[model samples]
Target: KYVPIENAKYTLTERFVDEEGNEISPSVVKGTDYEEGSEYDVTGDAKVIDGYYLKETSNTTGKFGKGDMTATFTYAKLGKIIPVDPEGNPIPDAPTPQYPNNPTDPGKTTPDQPVPEIPGYRPEVPSVTPTDPGKDTPVKYVPIENAKYTLTERFVDEEGNEISPSVVKGTDYEEGSEYDVTGDAKVIDGYYLKETSNTTGKFGKGDMTATFTYAKLGKIIPVDPEGNPIPDAPTPQYPNDPTDPGKTTPDQPVPEIPGYRPEVPSVTPTDPGKDTPVKYVPIENAKYTLTE
Candidate 1:
């Protein structure tokens, strides 16, 4: 018969699926039909006829999720109903022994989630205390593009020049939009970088910052004692020869790091002379002396 959400009654099946694609035959669920709707929701263990009513629903029927553990009850009417609880009980231990319905999906347990042991493992989680502000945490960031590796490639370019992708520490570290790494760069340990002063960074991080500037690193292109071209070193763009087009190094004329200075006020006699405070200073270059 058709039933409403409240004051509802429905039947369920007894046979179910076991994990590993096996079939499971469950004992039938036996219960009297309770009306569906809001009155059914008396949460927690309440004494029903035989088992505990574990839910707040009026209807005697329940639904199940896939791969979840469920309890099957053989209704006294020779029918079945699924309950949220895994332990199937025909009669409530206590009247209205209630918990919510369908705690988990049936037959959907994965290989990893074995049937939980009676004494389950429960770890204690520490509570966060707002009053404890005395702790400190360290931070470090490493980028993937900065790492270097040896690769086999063709020795000649389309113009019969060489195509090399050699990188150096500090020297070729690309300055991307996200990080501000303006440093007096120095090459160190293979392909990594650190600031000349307080600079901080990871080795082999960031992109090939100066793929265009590789020719500037003179020592990379090796030669025999007689200065013959190394078999793979392409005829450098600078060609290490003063006569070559690269009369300058890639990082050359590196424009000085920009500086910032607060704007001078009009200094009118009627204005708040020497009393106004600057809201902000964009560039903090403390090296240069101010005349005002």
Candidate 2:
């Protein structure tokens, strides 16, 4: 008497290999197997087969009744093929596989390798190099085409000594953008600020430079009773004076004039210079006695 065993069921899965030979799990079920023999035959199919070729067909188990079988069908992708120019020749380099011998098989090859760089010819697709086959792989060769410029500030004290901690060391600006420089120079005691150069207009293609200069305050001079500055005066002593060079001699009282009595007793001068003449109105208007 011969006993018939129940037919075992086998599952076939399809995987794709990309141009770089990276393995990619595709959502495809080739078929199911229900054969009664120890050794079973299996076949697979793909809805889309563009840029791909059947590389291998294998199974986890050769005997059907031993265990559940997984038949894996791997497809290798053709190299991305593109032309260097409109004429369609001289293709760019193909994606290099991370593992030479056992390249991970991704599902499909790149659409086309970027065209080799040629004078006056630009590729429609940007050139990108595939990283090692894995989740969240970083992309290579990002392009930067925007123009950039730099703004620099220089500060100096009245003695030409560089001030500590520059106001604005350097700043970056896009081309054609404006940079404000009105407040670049800082105020210092006993010194006046003078801006020599600044970036007020739209930024240009090249780097920008700003400059500032400071001047010391001028000395204050004192005037004497004669309205003339004391000659050969020394620098004024700070916060003190009995003989402070900035001090002036006390004014002498004006002598009494007989014909014209002065209306004011004395005049004081704040600044050193020639004395200002005093104007006096006649005390009494003369009628010449009208008789003579």
Tens digits of per-residue lDDT, candidate 1, 136-191, equal 11111222333332211222222434344433433433333232233323232111
Worst 10 residues of 1 by lDDT: 114-123
> What TM-score would every model get versus the actual structure?
0.13, 0.28
lDDT of 2 at 101: 19
Winner by TM-score: 2
Expressed as tens digits, the lDDT of each residue in 167-221 for candidate 2 is 5445567667776785556654444454456636676544576766655433333
What is the number of residue pairs that collide in model 2?
12
> Which model scores highest in lDDT?
2
